[model samples]
Target: TGVASGIAQWENNAFPGDRLDQLDVTNGQVFVQKVDGPVQFFAQLGAYSLPDLGSPYIRSGKATGNFYGAFPQWFVKYAPNDSMSVLAGNLPTLIGAEYTFSFENVNVERGLLWNQENAVNRGVQVNYTTGPLALSFSWNDGFFSNRYSWLWGSATYTINPSNIVAFIGGGSVNTETVSSAVTPLYQNNEQIYNVIYTHTSGPWTLVPYIQYTSVPSDPQLGTAQRASTFGAALLATYALDGGYSVAGRVEYISSTGDANAGAPSLIYGPGSNAWSLTITPTYQKGVFFARGELSYVKATSTTPGFAFGPTGTNTSQTRLLVETGILF
Candidate 1:
């Protein structure tokens, strides 16, 4: 799949702000998969220059020069029996509601909570499935870092084909030299709970989801801190005549945590809340599709940099974005 996009944005007030307008190729990739007997191989390589539209609400890493980027997925899977399988390589993390692929999501930009979660895992995994219940376990390099190790487990229950619930938990620990004479091992733990329901009737389809994440303090730090975030999202799409459709999404996320005194953690800072609404109208014909989206985000926080401006200032911020994309 390949995608090209143009974006325009505006913010009420911000510090170290991002570019307000840009055009780039968001995704250009080819996926190849081969299946033979019980063995399967898959790989996705791509070049992207999409705008950073999620974290901090505005700025992100952008591809430089020509079209060049990193491969997001590559893995191999082997099924030993009807109910068991093994996989190894750089694979997508099993913890999030949104996928790494842009086309697989309902909106052009991912939600606030999704941006903070892990994106990929490099290691091995095992899965077992029976009836409507599936269980999986994995050990991998933490997030995008190979210096740390993480272990994850997930259980999914299917209540019929349209309703499902899943629970995923993972954690990692790393030892770092704090100073010239002392080294402390830091522990990071995370857990996610999710529920999803999909219902389709006539030309209308609706999906409602809820997710929660918890993070405890690192014992190695000078100040112990704990953080948690709870979020919910709803997506709805209505199909129209002549291969046209309208889709919309609404999401809310709230986070709470204490500021760390030493090493940085992945948890959100103290007392922050955000909500967004997006509407996309699209046209699809065969392998070609075009979509236009309008989105708005409003956030509030007591922590300075946590919301808009530098620390100890700026209490709230709002952002609006317009994006258009075409994919083949």
Candidate 2:
């Protein structure tokens, strides 16, 4: 797989080295997997960018080197029976509805709610399927911190051919002070939960999900007060004729805490809230694909010097993105 993209934005949150207009490699990757036998393995090697809403953009080269390295995901699975399997690896996380990479998502840039979730981790996972229900549990490093002190689980049920629901949750078993490009210290120690529903009928697919995350007060962790976030999002896609499709997403998220009490900044800042809307139109044929995205974000109750623009005082931002890629 490969991707190249360009971005144009207003109210750019000029985070020192970031820019208002940029060109970058979105994905340069390959996958290798074997899934037919009792011993199965999957490996993904490449460089990729993690473009996200309300955050500074990191180039693909730096993202690959600073976050998960060149080989982001590789796993070995043992399946002695048809209903159960055990996997050990640098695994994809089960905490959120969105995936880690651009090609795996409906929109080019992730939503505001995704900013509060973990993407990938190093861990062990077990999966089982029975009837219409599927279950997965894992012991992993939360926030890719490599501390190996997090427990995560998910339960999914299929109600019919067109309806499915899932409940997912995860948290750190111990406070981890690790901080890096992939791991934010406060988020690494927080507990997160999600409730998601998916419905598909003919040419339309819809997904709705709600998320909650809480970071407790721990002086040892440099947090003097507890802070939490409540978020909701809806993502939908409509397939049109002649290899065309359109996707849209809307999200709202708010944090709870008093800035005066030394609460950690979660979103724009403590006690801040944000909402976003995104639209993507896509065209794909055979091994090639292209997409264009338009998105807008607005923040309220934000602290000074913590929002958007070069001065970090702007409350709104708009962006346009174009990406062309191939999956071969």
Scored by lDDT, the top model is 2
The digit string of per-residue lDDT tens for model 1 on 1-328 reads: 4555454555544445443444445556667787676999888776543332334432223442221236667889998788999999887878766765556666666666565566666889999999998999988764545544578788888877656677776756443323210011222245556666667778888877787776556564443666667888888989999999998888888876655433233323465677777787887777666677776666665455545454425544455555555665
For model 2, which pairs clash?
A: none
Lowest-scoring 10 consecutive residues by lDDT in candidate 1?
Answer: 179-188
lDDT of 1: 0.62
Q: Candidate 2's residue-wise lDDT over 48-148, tens digit each? A: 89989889889888999999999899999999999999999999989888999988898989999999999889999999999999999999998889799
Scored by Cα lDDT, where does model 2 land?
0.90
Each candidate's number of clashing pairs is 0, 0
Off by over 4 Å in 2: 1-13
What local lDDT does model 2 show for residue 251? 96
